[model samples]
Target: MSNSPSRSVIVTGASGGIGRAVAERLAADGMSVLVHYAGNPATAEEVVAGITASGGTATSFGGDVADETAMANLFEHATTIFGGIDVVVNAAGIMPLAPVATMDLETFDRVQRTNVRGTFVVSQLAARSVRAGGAIINFSTSVTRLQLPTYGAYAMSKGAVEALTLILARELRGKDVTVNVVAPGPTATPLFFEGKPQEVIDRIAGANPMERLGTPQDIAETTAFLAGPARWVNGQVIYTNGGAA
Candidate 1:
């Protein structure tokens, strides 16, 4: 087997939450990581610091995941820093909850732009750049399956992600690169807890057979598998929701 240090990953939105966890996990497994952040450079830097402190190779880059030029530059920058790219994880996204009837076009467009367009832009770059046997892991949501109220727009964006992931896997035929999606359900991130009442949180948690919210580490474990050893699992969505379905 090739040495683990030879592999490198670009994880968008790596400042915190699932992204940070994924970056850290990949680094711990001996892959170099590019911790991409959209807005908070400090947090992204902190993630890099933590990785380095653990004797893991990591660096932080700032850019909008939806911009084609910016993302291309990010891919190039990561290559320059790490020698080559083996995994691309589209973990950067936004979630705004509102019923379809009450949702304004601005909010709808914003979510679609970041979640759908961003994934497309990143996947396009990854398709063009990933090495043979590399992996492209996109983020989706279990809400796409649960179909809860106020998640219409968010679910719509993730639905598009699922479509993109499967099709891209086929497009990369013969390249030995795998494209897949990781759909998390009600993860215990700061953004998930905001504005949610304890009763509401508990109810959602109980809906899952595990009876608890998923940690960022839980989602990271799934990502680590797809990025490294799960070659046969391509063009599919792995719902890491503790049996919420």
Candidate 2:
């Protein structure tokens, strides 16, 4: 691995929203970033271009976090392009809401596959590859604490992430690598606003103590901190929810 201060970091789901913000922020902090996306090549390229244009180093790769081969390729490319990775942020997730009685099994399964299993796969790779003094940041949600209706499946998935972070931290005890999770409140993202009426959106936003939904940048800030210079903080789910949770 290169001994340069500019370390390499990977941000999964960097096509848009919080993932994009996190990738850009890390790049701005002088890290060589690997921006991973699932299907949106254009968006991923846009992120990479934005970083490079700003005099930072970044590259975009398209791969499903749930696929083992794709994830292997992602790590290989990261190491090949920017040297060994020092940080990994697992920000890829899906939230499809429905009452448990009415939710389709397929949809629930997909949520778990992407949100829970995807984190597992990426974290596993990071465990084997990230250098000492590095960190793994996983995504959870404040909804798990809120216990909101129609979010059972999503909360369950994040709960799994919380458990994973705790266990992984213990497993990595002597490695100087910290494992943690970030649980954000309702954020103002395309995914959050999709299919929701204005009234419902307003209510959701007002539900939080801050009286407004979070911005992608808000969540990104916490992720950036966890990835660098937050080595003493580990095995904890830091909830950045504007005091809502």
**Best lDDT among the predictions, by candidate number:** 1
Colliding residue pairs in candidate 1: none
TM of each candidate vs. truth: 0.98, 0.97
Give me the runs in candidate 2 sitting further than 4 Å from their true place.
1-5
The best candidate in terms of TM-score: 1
Candidate 2 — worst ten consecutive residues by lDDT sum? 1-10
Give one digit per residue, the lDDT tens place, for model 1 in 10-73: 9998999999999999999999999999999999999999999999999899899999999999
Candidate 1 ranges with C-alpha deviation above 4 Å: 1-3
Q: lDDT for each of the candidates? A: 0.94, 0.92
